[model samples]
Target: MIDNGDDSLIFAPENGKTAEKVQEEYWKVLIVDDEPDVHSTTKLVLEDFSFEDKGLKFISAYSAKEAMEILNNQKDIAVILLDVVMESNSAGLQLAKIIRNEMGNRFSRIILRTGQPGEAPEKKVIAEYDINDYKNKAELTSQQLYTSMFSALRSYRDLKIINKNSEGLKQIINSTANLFQRQNVEQLAQGVLTQVVSILGLENSYYVSTSGFTAAQTSDSDFRIIAATGRFTKCIGTKVEDCTPIPADIVPYLQEAISKEKSGFIDTHYVGYFPTMKDKIHLLFIEDCSKDLGPEIENLLTIFNHNAGIAFDNVILNKEIHDTQIDIIYHLGEVVENRSKETAYHVKRVSEYTYTLAREMGFSEEESQLFKMASPMHDIGKIGIADSILLKPERLDHDELNIMRTHTEIGYNMLKSSSRPLLQTSAVIARDHHEYWDGSGYPRGLKGEDIHPAARIVCLADVYDALGSKRVYKEAWKEEDVLTFVRENRGKMFDPKVVDALFTAYERISRIKERFKDPE
Candidate 1:
């Protein structure tokens, strides 16, 4: 549309001829010739030219210096109609070097049009420089110019596509890696939306899924936005019908994809369909697509979407497995606690405290979680003790106390045969949770570093909780007294580091008792 510099000139299609409608996209053509008449004549010849349903946008520069300014500002110029001997005998030839090497634009096609063939021979120009085609000014015709443009524009278009897709594939591979690191379905859904936006080079995206994990209903109306990016961030948790930013008409097509369980490009937008194993559905929506955006993106999205669905399903299934395992451990612990009329929440409180203390000591979350799970079964051996010894109202005599201590060995035997890591961990915890740090007090009398770190951590957590809780024979000690006792027995009764961690995290870990409180 812009024809020249400083002076303005506009061209319109002739009225009698069947004209091409104005296209949204244009192939930029830069005309670099110092002669004013040459600029005028070249525009007249290529004035009606169109390539790939797009018209030409001509940029005029009178010298090599002026052309450099235009090239510096505009990045997507498709063709340069360069003239030799502009400012010098080899101005156009040198400009070609700048365009290829200094400017670093490899996609733009350059065709040399020179009046002085003697100044720069066609053979030498084509062989030395990166120029695509060389034309003698006297023999160049209107039809020849058109033919040259068709070849140049098509090559530029294809080069750009190959580069864009290569970059897009790199983004998808990294995005899929990020998706796998997410710990929950919500995080994976958000990751899917982010990666899709990055691949498509769009700014906005959102994920929609059924509200319940076990979705019994399937309809466009049932989908709610689970995650979103950009201006749509506030739309999360909103029903698709209520989200105003989303085009309302796109809903039916989304339902169609979900109904058919397919993911592909729609008429204008990219629709992502993810059906989870829990009978749930997740859909990703990318907005404001380009005319060139189509099946080219489908291949990249297919690889990324496949990983997204698997990641979401894995998180959901792993969470279900963890929940079921925790339920069984608590039920079994609660059984042992009831035999001696202990607080049902006692096992839960100690479990929370053990997790808090282990993490405070710089343990990994995975290791700390194992401690949380294993702490509930620490008193499991008490199940083997007689009610007369286990439930005695008063302090047990020496013989009766020794019988009670055998319960730890009994619990160890109960779980020691299992091959599972969790059960084997629980067996060690049940056996050593009662051991003293100084090699003086336990069925095993294990000393110092000889105790398993998990058992050492639970030992401190168990006694700290027991001292603060009320028993049938002894009243509950105050917080001040409990702290004083733990501080004084730092190495005598507990692992010194675990004792220190408990004190450092006393405010946070002590609150666990308040949360999982003994029921009145």
Candidate 2:
């Protein structure tokens, strides 16, 4: 430990103290003074001084202008010992002011040294220059010089550490914001990995997060390749099984951490290790082949492990919610199937058919998907009808048929007024599907121009599905027969424009039929 008045320069101290060792561990210090004796004297005092196991390396500059040259070229200079009365009476003071106020050398500690105390008063010089220390050259004994150098060096080291951490924190915050903006889990995972690698200063890497379906009973882990920053041959979507096995070097550590659900850091650069996540521990892998990582990279890995796990949980929850909604819709479609002898595949086929027709009609992809989902609910009102009327093989009497016709009104009443896309389209179909272009049908009896386009489109899908499918009351018709029936009814039972659109979509309709073919 070296002491300089109120300041202490105690470096933790490496195994040995030497100028080479100090230069290797700490930022270089430059001394600017006019006197040749001061440079030699200062070096002798600090030759053995070590701060935090690091000794200080010193460079000497004769004047303020010389110091600026050194400052301009040597970015590693962390601190400077300056004299206030070099060249001109106040040149050192002016240089100190310029270094701080103009050059923006905030990180380098500046100590102003002067021998002619009368030329510039201590109080005035201290106020004018943003120097860390003010000292009379004559008063700075060997011990005092050693102590001042150590204290200034320590402050410089601490400031550098603080700045690096601040930059890392900023990177983390920006990456977290990006993660939040992502709509898919892959994107979120990518953001997390990118931030982590950057903060740790890793060269290039990839991240994988693994989790299970349930908290306790997950099968083979679900792996998500969240982020990749380096030039790896594998793509982001590549599964764990597709990649080469974990390198023999990292496999054991990874397996142990994964089994215990504990986080760990590895030193291998060629292959990265992460535990397989079953129900709990979400695994992450990073392939960083760079040679620069040591304890700093390990520190980052520890920080990232927990953050990434939480992110994976959020992604899984979102996926589960999306899948649950689809399952509920599927079961609801099944309920419609129970109302008639139509299989659940019938609803699927009609949705596909509707999507194809909408696509052929030049609708946007979003509208086509909406039509696909809504088309399944076109017959949803049949759920309200009795099996006796729905399954009757014989022709109904006029009154029985009238009650059956009320199914359209029932379907409309059940779905109308709801704001959901599926319900809204179903409502339109239920209300106007039976209406003729000539205004000779039931419900609202809307005419051609007045009918909602959604209803008109579904009318074609419903009729085509009905004609092509075998039902309790009617056998399935041949493709040619169905086309003839549709052509015969065009402009009478169906909208003429819609019939024209349907004819254009015959190829698409056939493809939908082939794609969603029934198992039975």
Give the top-scoring candidate (TM-score): 1
lDDT per residue (tens digit) for residues 90-144 in model 1: 8998999999999998999998988789999877888899988888776666667
Clashing pairs in 1: none
lDDT, candidate 2, 1-520, per-residue tens: 2335555333223334234443556558798988776676566556766776777677889999999999988877877988877889989888988888888889899887788899878898778668888878656565677667778887987787667656655655566566666656666656655555555453222332221110111235534334455443243455444334334454454455557666544453322232323254444445443445545455555555555555566666776766675566556766877667775478777777777777777789778776776666676677777888878888888987887788788878887888877668767776677777778877767888787766677777878877888777778899899999889988877888778878887787788787877666
Candidate with maximal lDDT: 1
- As a TM-score, model 1 comes out at 0.71
TM-score for each candidate, following the candidate numbering: 0.71, 0.63
List where candidate 2 sits over 4 angstroms from the true fold.
1-25, 30-50, 53-77, 83-105, 115-120, 127-129, 166-188, 202-242, 269-280, 287-303, 338-343, 346-513
Clashing pairs in 2: 11-51, 11-52, 12-52, 12-53, 13-53, 14-53, 190-226
Mark the 10 consecutive residues where model 1 has the least summed lDDT.
208-217
lDDT over C-alpha atoms for residue 257 of model 2: 51
For every candidate in turn, the CA RMSD to the true structure comes to 7.1, 8.1
